[model samples]
Target: METPIKIDISVIVPSYNGMPLFKTSLDSVLAQEGVIYEVLVGNDSPSDGETKNYLNQIENKDLRVFHNEKNLGLFGNLNNLIKHAKGDIVHLWSQDDIMNPNCLLETVKFHNSHPNIAYAFSRVEVINEHDEVIDKTPLSNNDTMSALTHTLTSLMAGSVPGNIANVSIRKNIFETYGYFDVNLKYSGDFEFWCRITEHLPVGIIQKYLIKLRRHTGQLSRNPKMWIYRIEENDAILETLLNRVPKNKLKYINRGLKWRVYNQYFGLYLNLLRSGDNKEAQAFLRVIKKYSNISGFYFRYVILKILSVIKRDKKFLHWLYYKQAFGNNGK
Candidate 1:
């Protein structure tokens, strides 16, 4: 009699509102060449029949699907999926992202080799809605949590040089550290990684193994939600600041500058979409308040002022994102 294979990792994908991209994600999982794993898909949007049915039609026996009667949003869905996850490690799947075929096999190898590492991540490639490569993110494993803070507002989970799909966390972390906080209207993922990367040991695979798709219909499309997200992140920074050592103020300064920039940047994008600039300056006010007009942030703030003297919107996006994400191209 043949012995049943034991699953090495369980990938839990929390999905909603994605029609075209989900299939590509599933296909990538189905194409894996090595490693025995189970793919658990939490269909957060139960009413999303098109997404549910497409997931149900997959031929792989390693797939499991669950449905929520109503949408639980991103955090709730991930919480529910983790409860049902049986793997040693869990990969939070985003519906719109794509993973390389070797994603699982390679990740598992890293986790085993570096047992002290709580989880592992790889570099990510940014793609258009059409899956065309638009840009590549900095995936260098050079103290990401500290390096990114040198320019951005908060140490982001997504900015951990990888996408969620490229991350495989030991289920024990969730068991001990607790689930992603639901009260964080946004920034929950960033907060989760903040908890992990700060204390726990982590390692990286050093390969571009995932894609982050940028599109118009993404949920953060609601500028109000982004505004709220920014606010929530501000609170997180304050809480973290209280806990970090006074010697780390340099990190805090860098983070503060990034936060203020994004506050205005989000407002800027919303204004462009809505054709309103008068109220948008409210966000700009806070940005300028903390902007390092003479320092590292100088490279960004000066460009925008120069561009405005030159009259350009494209320069605005570049300048704003350079502030929000550390000139790490969006």
Candidate 2:
């Protein structure tokens, strides 16, 4: 009989014509040290000849490539990859992102030390298309912050403490909590984090172990994608509100308003800048739908008027920063 493979981590890369960028991602995973891991690349029916040829040329013993009969979107491809993963832990890697050499080593060490933690994530380094480091994620390192408080507060503030590329979770968590909601386009990962955090304590590694690439092709950069994100986030917040304890109701409600206000305001600004008046008005309507607080509307009108008067993107951005973070920039 053939000997069974004992893989500690499975790094699943879901690709759809992500070539040039995909090669960088694959190379990083191959270079990971201090772990028995396998790299699985799921090609979502690449129609491009070059991408197909690239997949055909992969000959690594530790890497396996699978192709879908038809095109499955991001979450769909992720689900398929999960089904094929044979490792005890799974890391859903992004096709355009690069992993730090110690990503797997650090994540495995953390999980081993904290056997109770089902989900583990580390800090992220944000990079641009040219591979230049732009920013590092500001994930709180205060050990006093409870997992529930950290997760809820982050989500409510319209931010994620860690990106998907830096996350690793036990395979059993999926069997217990269910897989990613394939229907959600933008907030699926966000919702999954919220859900899993409710059931299991999350482990945080303060090191920057993943590079999240920001480029024009990224879905979040697409102006049209914000509409769907707003809708999905609203639904996610409603579900969270229902699950939160009564004692935490006040905090949850406050976070909800903050999240809604920021999302609507940002999208409204983007639409206005893009000269999409109709969409901008639609976003304003969404803002009113979420909150009747006079301050929210006051800021909306102020920003709209300022945008028209200045018509300078940089000045408008400065104005937004001043209003949102105060003049001292804190």
Candidate 3:
């Protein structure tokens, strides 16, 4: 009789013509030890066919490859890959990310020990295009932060579990919470992570698990993608704000507004200086849409005037720092 395979985790990578970079990412996953995991690559119909040709050349018992009929945008591609996953745990890996050898082993161990947590993310080393480590995600004193704290950090500061490579989720969690929203081009993962935190406590592994590569070609860095991100942030904030307890509402709300004001407002100033008037107006609308905090328009007008006058670059830079950070650049 043939034996059934026992797969504990499915490391899914959704790819679209990243070529040699995808090879590096897949190689890292294939090298992981001490875990019964399968690597699934969802080739999102790359025009170049390079990924398909490359996958055909590799022969590994643990690797499975699936090709999409058409290009499903990022989140849609992810949802498609999730459907094909066969493991209890699903690890969404970016096509350009490099995983540490122990990443799968450590995550499986963490899940085995803490059975109640829906998802967990490990710290990641942020790497540049040349594969040099530039920075990393912060370490938490505890294994998991409270859902409220995680939500606040995700909404008001920067995203927690910053990229797909750092996070691993139990397959059932997707069944319970639904898939990533396909409409969100740039921020769907951020929105989905926030949604999960609403009901479950998210775990954190202090170890650096992956090298998240940063390059200009990524959607998040493109100026054109920022508008989509702004649109998604509105919905994300509304859902999180409604979930906060009344006692914490006031402070959380204030912090949220301050974050929106600085984030979009700073972008608005830069757009104006660069003479990208249309985008600058779009960012202005986003700031007005999310924040009702005082001094926004006042500061906007000042920055606009300074930008128009073409004042000293140093003074404008200092003024921006003062306006955006205020009080020791908080």
> Which consecutive 10 residues in model 1 have the weakest lDDT in total?
143-152
Candidate 1 positional error at 271, Å: 1.8
- Better by TM-score, candidate 3 or 1: 3
lDDT string for model 2 (13-34, tens) is: 8898888998889899999999
Better of 1 and 2 by lDDT: 2
CA lDDT, every prediction?
0.67, 0.75, 0.79
Alpha-carbon shift of residue 141 in model 1 (angstroms): 6.1
Model 1 agreement with the true structure over 1-330: per-residue lDDT tens digits: 998677788888888867777878777776776888888888888778898788777777888888888878788888888888777877777887887888888788877777665566677888887789999866564522342342133342233533466677888888878998887756787778766655555666777777778787776555645546666677666655665555545544544444445445646556757866654655454445445435424545554676678844455444344444443535
Clashes of 1: 0
Colliding residue pairs in candidate 3 = none
**Over the stretch 210-265, how does candidate 3's per-residue lDDT look in tens digits?**
89999999877766567667776777878877876676576566555444455577
Better of 2 and 3 by TM-score: 3
Q: TM-score, each model?
A: 0.77, 0.84, 0.86
lDDT of 2 at 89: 87
Arrange candidates, best lDDT first.
3, 2, 1
Order by TM-score, highest first: 3, 2, 1
Native-vs-model 2 lDDT? 0.75
Over all chains combined, what TM-score does candidate 1 have? 0.77
